[model samples]
Target: MLHKWILAAFVSLLGTSSLLADETTQARCVVDDKRRQICLDHPAQRIATLSPGATELMFAAGGGDQVVAVVTFSDYPPEAQAIESLGSLTRLDMEKLISLQPDLVIAWVTGNPAEQMERLEALGLKVFYLEPRRFADVSSTLLRLAHLAGSDDVGQQVAQAFEEGINNLQQRYQNASPVRVFYQVWNDPIMSVNHEHLIHQVIELCGGDNVFADLPRMIPRLDTESILSANPEAILAGGMGEENQAWLDHWQQYPHLHATADQNLYFIPPSLIQRPTPRLLQGAERFCQALDEARAKRQ
Candidate 1:
C-alpha cells in the first residue's frame, strides 16, 4: 500500500545530499526519540509538502505562499487544496515530484517507506521529514518551519493564538464537567486515539473522557462491543464526509449507546480534529463551545 520513492525523495532532502547546497548558515539537525530526522535550515522557498501533517505545519508557519505542490490528501486551509496534487502519501508519483522541481520537499518519515526515501536521496532532492508524536511538538515543528519560510512573525502569531485557545479550554474545563466521549477515527471494525496522542489530548482538553484511553496506539483498531460497553455519552466521529453518512447514521440501531439512543453522535470534519495545525485550536475552541452547550441542555 506504500510507495517506496516517496521515502527516497524525502531522505534525499534532509542532509549531506548532493542537493544540500553550501548554505550561509551551518546545517543543523535533530533526531527525535523515534530516530526520525529533520532539517532546520537551507529551507527551500518553492516547497512541496508530501503529507498531511507537513502541509498543516507549512500553513501554520505562513509558508503557504512558498508551497509549490502538495499531496492529494492535503485539503485543509482551502488554500493548500489549490496546489498541484502530487498524489497520495502512500502512492507518490516520482516523475511528477522530480518534474515539479521544487527546491524543498517535506515528508512524513513515519508514514513513508524506506525505499522511497533512499530513491529521493539518490536523485538529490532536499527533503525535510516531519515526525510528530505529541501535541506540543506540533507547535515546535511549526516554529521550525516558520523560521525556514522566513515567516517567524506569522508563526509566532499562529502559535500564540493556538496556545491561548488551549489555555482557555483548560481553564474552562478544569475542576468542572467532563463529558464521556467516544472519538472514533475510523470504523470498518473501529478505531480510536490513544492517551499519548494529540487527538486524545484534544478530547481531554474539551473536558471529555476518551472511551479508549487505555489503548496504547495513536490510532488503534477497536471492537464495536467495546463501544457498547463504554456507552459513550457522545460519539465524535473523525474523517466524516458525504460517503460515510449512511454508515455513521447506523449507530441508531445500537440501543445501548447514549450517543445512538439520544442521537448525540456528531460528525465534524476530520481536519478540525485530526490536524495538529494552528487551525486545531480554533476547531477545539469552537467544538468545546458546542459540547458545553450540549452538556448544559442535557443537564
Candidate 2:
C-alpha cells in the first residue's frame, strides 16, 4: 500500500492533460499533489517557482521563459541562476513576489513554509503543490507541468526520455548482487533517509540495501556508533558542493570499518540526487557505477 500522498500523485500523473480546451488559449487544468483541481483560464504566462527542484522541473517542462521568479539556490540548468530571486523558500519577499504577479506558482509541499503558500492561495494565485517522492512522480510531473505551461511537445519528449533512462537503469541493475549501503545526506547531525525517501529507492534500484531503510523517521539523525554497528559495505555521501570531499574524507578515520578499509566511500553530487527531477537518472547512473566499484573491491 502506497502512502496517500504518493498514491494521489501517481493517479494525478496518469490524468496529465495535454489537450487544450482551446488551442488558441490553453485552459490548463491539473490535479496537484494536494488533490485540488487547479485550472488556469489561460496558459500560465508568468510562473514563480518557490523551490530549487520546482525551478528545475519547470525548466525541464520547457517553461523557462514563463518562469518570472525563483527562490534561492535554483542554480541548475545553468540558465536558472539568471532568473530573478524572490529570496529563499522560507523567507520569501512577499512584496517582490506580488509585484511579479505570477499566474502560476509551482510550490514545494514540504520544502516551503505552509503559511507562505496559504498567503499565495489566499491572494488567488494558482498554486500547484508538488512533492515527488518516486521516480515515476518525477517524470510524470514534467508532462503535467508542461501542460500547465502550454509546452506539451517539449514536456512529452523530456518526460519520455526520463522514463526510458530510468527503465534502462532498472533493467541493467535489477538482478545484480545487493551491496550494503549507507547514504549520508548530512554528516554533522548524521542524517540518513529511510525507505520512504527517493534516495532509498535509488539504492534499491542499484541493488544496494540501505542499512537504515527500516527506520521510522523519513530522514533519521544517526550516530557514528550506530553506523558502525550496521556495518554497511559501501558508504555514499553528498556534500555542500560538487567538489567537496570533506564528508567522505571524515569517514577515513574509521579504517576498521568495511567501507573505510575497502575505500568504498563515494560522492554523488547533492544537486543531482537530492532534487527530485529528471536529473535523478544521471544521479542514479552515477550511484550504480559507484556500487559496481564497491563490488569490485570485494573481488
Candidate 3:
C-alpha cells in the first residue's frame, strides 16, 4: 500500500509539470503578405522598421515604444526620429541592427535589399514584409503589426478609425463630378503613376480621372510635350517641401494648358500621400478638396 501511494503521487506530479510547460509555451501565429505562417512563442518585445512607411505603421499599431531601430527619413509621429538608425533604405548598418537584438524586423517588399533580409532570417530573426497598396491594406497591416507586439487593442482602434475615415470620404464624394487630373511625382523627369499605384486609387476616390493612369510602368517618365497633349484640367504636385510651389509655378509658363489657364494648381505634402499609413486619410481628404475646387472653377 505504501508503494502504490508513492507511484500515484509521482504520476500526478509528472502531469502537473507537463501542463505547466504547455502553459508557458503558448504561441501566436499570423500569415504575412508572402503567405507564410509566422509563429512566435510570445509577442515580440523588440522591433526594427526598415522603411519610413514601416516606422509610421509601427506607431499606428501602438507599438512605437517597442521600435528600437528605423531607417532614414522616418520623421512621422515625431518620436520615430529619436530611434536608432539602421541607415537609409538602400543602405543598412547590419552591425547596429544585430546589436539592437530585435526579436522581429519589418521589411519593405522592394525597398529593403533582399540579401540583407536573408542574412537576418538566417540569423534566426523573424521578418515581416510590408507593402500596402490599398486603403484596406493600410489598416490591416496596422492590426497585424499590433498583434505581433501584443497591442491589439490600440491597433484595432487605429485600424477601425482609418477604415471609417476612408468610407466617409467615399460617401462624401459619391456624387462629385469627375475632374481631369495630372499628378506630378517629380518635376524634372515629369514622373506619374499608373493605374495600379495607390495615388491613382486616391485620384479615383476623389472622383477625378488621372490622365496618365493608363501608363505601362508603375511610375512612368514623360516629357513636357505629353502634358501639353493631355492638357489635364487640374495639376497637383507634391513638391520638395511641405510648402514648395515651384513645381506648380513652372506650369504657369504654359498658359495655353487647361490647368494653367484655370489656375487649378494644388499641392499635397509628399509625406502624407507617399507613405502608406493612417496619414493617407489626410492626403485623400486634401485630394478630394482640391478636385472639388477644380470642379467649382468649371462652373
How do the residues 192-256 of candidate 2 rate in per-residue lDDT, one tens digit apiece?
99999999989999999999999999999999999999999999999988879799888899989
| Candidate of highest lDDT | 2
lDDT of 3 at 27: 49
Better by TM-score, candidate 3 or 2: 2
Candidate 3 lDDT, 122-180, residue by residue in tens:
99999998777777677667767877787878877887788788889999998888899
Clashing pairs in 3: none
What residue pairs are clashing in model 2? none
- Kindly state the number of residue pairs that clash in model 3: 0
Show the lowest summed lDDT stretch of 10 residues, model 1: 1-10
RMSD of 3: 11.1
* Steric overlap count per candidate: 13, 0, 0
What TM-score would each prediction reach against the true structure? Answer: 0.81, 0.93, 0.88
* Superposed model 3: Cα runs more than 4 Å off: 1-26
Reference-based TM-score, model 2 = 0.93
lDDT tens digits by residue: candidate 1, 22-72: 344645443333445645455457888888768878987889899988887
